[model samples]
Target: MTVYRRGLRFLRARRRAVAALAAWSVVEAGQTFLVGYALARALDEGFLAGRARTGLGWLGVGALAVVVGAYGTRRVYGCVAALVEPLRDQLVRHVVARGVREGDGGALSGLTQQVEIARDTFAGLVMVSRSFLFTAAGALIGLCSLDPLLLLVVAPPLAAGVALFALTLRPLARRQEAFLVADEEIAAHLGGICPALRDITAAGAEALVTADAGARIGVELRAARSLARRGVLRVACLAVGGQLPLVLLLATAPGLLAHGVTPGALVGALAYVTQSLLPALQNLVHGLGTSGSRLEVVLRRLTPDPPPAAAGPAVTRQAAGPTAGGPARPAAQPRPLGVPVCADHPPARGPALSVSALTFAYGPGAVPVIENLDLRVPRGAHLAVVGPSGIGKSTLVALVAGLLEPTSGTIRVLGQPVRGRAAHGRTARGGSARIQPVRGPTACGQRVLIPQEAYVVTGTLAENLGQLRPRPVPEAELRAAAEAVGLGRLMERLGGPAAEVDPRALSAGERQLIALTRAYLSYAPLALLDEATCHLDPEAEERAERAFAARPGGTLVVVAHRISSARRAARVLVLDGRRALLGDHDELVERSPLYRELTGSWSRADSKPALAPRDPDRVDPVAGPGLAGDRRHVVAHGPVGQMQAARDLGDGGTRGREG
Candidate 1:
């Protein structure tokens, strides 16, 4: 129904062309009727009465009608072009707009593949639908004029065939939609894996990838076969509807003659069945069956719900809370130190981060990973978040970074509320609730997030480092930031910032260090590091953490992978799957069992530390002398560095004994 409405609207926009098409269709239908009438006169008045000249004269008039009909058909094609082109343009504009808003690859497929299908299908549908209507009307009139009894014999069967065909339309459309969905899934799967082929090969996972692709292909194959089965039913309907009427007329001719049906009228009736009714019905079955369904699907996708308002009363409630209405209630009272507060409390002025009653789940029915969580970090605060693997640490960070939408809540950064939907009572409602990525001054230059695995593109070191900046950073600043993160030696070895390097050539630790330096130079007001230093040595990790925290007016939130990172932070948040505990390191060690257990396990695992304990009087090399001898030492300095150092000392002792 939407497609029909939208199509009618489009046709109205080109009213002149549609009007012309309608005029031609009328002319075409009239010509068909005149030809059948002329043939009946030729048979009855000339040939049966033995006047050959008169029969030939009637035949010539029919020939003239055919020429006029040809001209009308030509004009109809022109009108079809006028209508289809503008519709295609409208569809293209809609598809492009959706692609920009959603940034989905499926939109690209729709734009390229589905739009073309809609255009072609719509054009064919217009021509066939117009022809069927006018021709069926003209044929019915001619049958009446020829003999009213002929209508009784042919009309009932004709109507029944058409009704049967109509019944198949919905099922055929459903099958078409299913086929398209299966095809899109295959395309999406292929697109997802193409860029990861190298990693798949390195992991020796070719068989697994092949199996996955094969399964998607199998689904597409089944859908295609189902669609084909539906198409066969359409053909059966066309044959019964269009061809069966002619067979009945021929078989009943002798009985009709005895009942006062003339031979000339019977011949005319044959002409009406063959030339007008049957062909029109055939075109309707083929054109409407396939194209009508495609047009419906395409229109629904092109027209989506309008975006929800950016700010609303619900958003105000989530951000500013009950105080926005009147005086604060008893529920707004501040909790004890390190205890999470409800959203009713006014946030600290100029807070770098604020979260109020946040909750998120992967989908509507899934268990929530974060629930009624509240957090605030003042400007320049250094906070460390720690949790066991899969405790939703990454999910939390992603929500804050605007990579995922929270089911219910509000997040504000640097006093500006991040845009999203607010939770109302117990349930979350659907709206334009997704928070757009922060940008401009509000984003605070990069708002950098360094993940556990660093990203390095194919480019010069300078270009890669300058990714966060709108313009190229000065050479001095680049060098200083690189030296601060211990990438100075690596930079020099690779021939400075201008040198091109393959990201794959660098060790994971080195890549993480480079990412750290990039963040250091970004000068973002807020930085989130999610286990970013897990691949680096303890000393290097400490230096990187200190550099980020030392940035002027910047806030740092690290998803700590080590107890050392937690100890360095002013406040630590320990997530234990079910609940989150927030406190200073010493307080959490005393009060929180999960924190104490984590630190105890860390201490046991790192019984003998390699990187010397923090002491103002002691100075250590950025990298020890044996770093080149064993790369694993550079990766982790606790146990691996000690083993490497002991091996070097053992080699020295053996040489001394030989001397």
Candidate 2:
């Protein structure tokens, strides 16, 4: 009902054009009856009485009616354009807005394919429906004028055929919906697997992947076949309803002739049945059955139902600390490291980061990778996240960044919600604000994310770094930022900040450094580095992290790739799939067996066993108070001293890190 009303509203804007079209449709329908009447006159008043001149006059009038009907048909197309183009524009706008809000690329398919189908189908439906109504009315009236009893002979079978065709409508629509679903499934499967083809082949899983894609294709084929079978029933209904009326009229002709039905009137009745009534019914059935079904499917998808709310009250549990049983508890309410607790809510202060009752899965019915997770990071805090490979570390970052939506949960950055499906945020000042799902600064210079691989477009080095800013960055400021993040040498080599350089020519580490410099220059208060420094040397990595953390009111969340990173952070979060353990590096080493195992593994892999050990009681060479305590001393001397400290720890310091 909503879709119908909306479509009607669009049409109403062009009511003058529609009125013109309706007037033409009436003229066109009346011409058909006029032609039949003129022919009947020619036969009865002139040809039957053997008067050549009278018959010729009537035949000329019929030819004139044909010309008028042709003109009306030509004018109707112009009216259709006035109605359909606005509808297309409106649909495009709607699809674009929805796509941006949801971070969905699938809306492109609707804009390109489905929108055209709706436009063309809707126009055809309007034309065919109007023509059918007008033509059927004119044909029935002509039959009654020819012989009052003709209605009794023709109307019953035509009504039965229309009713039967209507009966098949629901089934036909269901098949269409099924076919469309199968087609989208095939497209999504292929799109997902195509980028990973090299990996599938290298892993000797090509055949398995191909088999899965083949199954989706098979489902699409079956759906198409089912839809075709239902379409054949529409053709059958048209024949039974349209052609049967003609057959009945012909069969009863002889009996009618004996009961004072003149040959001229009988011929006119045949013309009304063949030329106007049957053809109009046939067109109506095909138009409504096919186009009407397609329109319904497209509208339903464009305006899908809202997602259901969270199943129960928000699950609050601590994300860290020991339990009563002497083992770390699996969950707990997330409390800020240094904030006064309020009776109803924590006071919004600093660069806030909060996640509550977060859960996510790839598809409905798939096992959740991250479930019921909660965490809070206070303003200006540097927190490192550590987890085993495939334990949902990157997924967690993506959800918080608003690159992907959670099945159910909320992510707040700087106290403003990062928008996603079923997620909403409040501003730091305690007012509601809906943040867009884009990867840039939100309200309050909120956040930015740098992935492992940096993105560099073809432009001057300064342009790439300053892309996040609204205006161009000054040369001196760019140079200082480059020096701070260890990009000074690269900038000098490239012939200053204005030099044009292909991002592809740079090494992975250099690109990461460039990205780090960009993030450093951004006003965003919360910076998420997802192994963004994996390619840089330890000295370069530390310099970049320190530069970002030193920013005013800035908070840092690093998906740590090394134990040293966790040690450098004020706090560390160890996600092991089953649960999360949050605490400072020293406390985590004693309470989290997973954290100790990861550090021990790093020590062995780097051949620096003496630096990091399994026992927490040992004086750890890399993270012990002696070396960790010297961080402030090293930073006080400026970039040169920070670079020197990073170089000393570069090799055999921390290795075999995991995301």
TM-score of model 1 vs. true structure? 0.51
Name the lDDT of candidate 1. 0.70
lDDT of 1 at 442: 22
* Model 1: per-residue Cα lDDT at residue 559: 83
Worst 10 residues of 2 by lDDT: 426-435
Error of 1 at 265 (Å): 2.9
Over the stretch 1-659, how does candidate 2's per-residue lDDT look in tens digits?
A: 46767767767878897898888887777677776677777888879879878988988988888888888888877777777787888888888989999977779888888888888888999888988888888877877777776777888888888889889988998888888889988887777677556434322235556787888889889989999999898888878878888898799989888887777777887888798888888898888887887888787777665677899987877544586768875643322111111233333553469998998888999888888899999988999988765567778876776667888888888677777522312111000111112222222235567766465655788877775554576666787778877888999999888899796587656777788877776656678888677656567788888877766567888987666778899989888775898999899989998888777665544422233222343222322111211221111111111222333443534222221
Off by over 4 Å in 2: 9-17, 99-112, 302-659
Model 1 steric clash total: 0
Quantify how close model 1 is to the true structure by its C-alpha RMSD in Å.
16.4
Per-candidate Cα lDDT values, in order, are: 0.70, 0.70
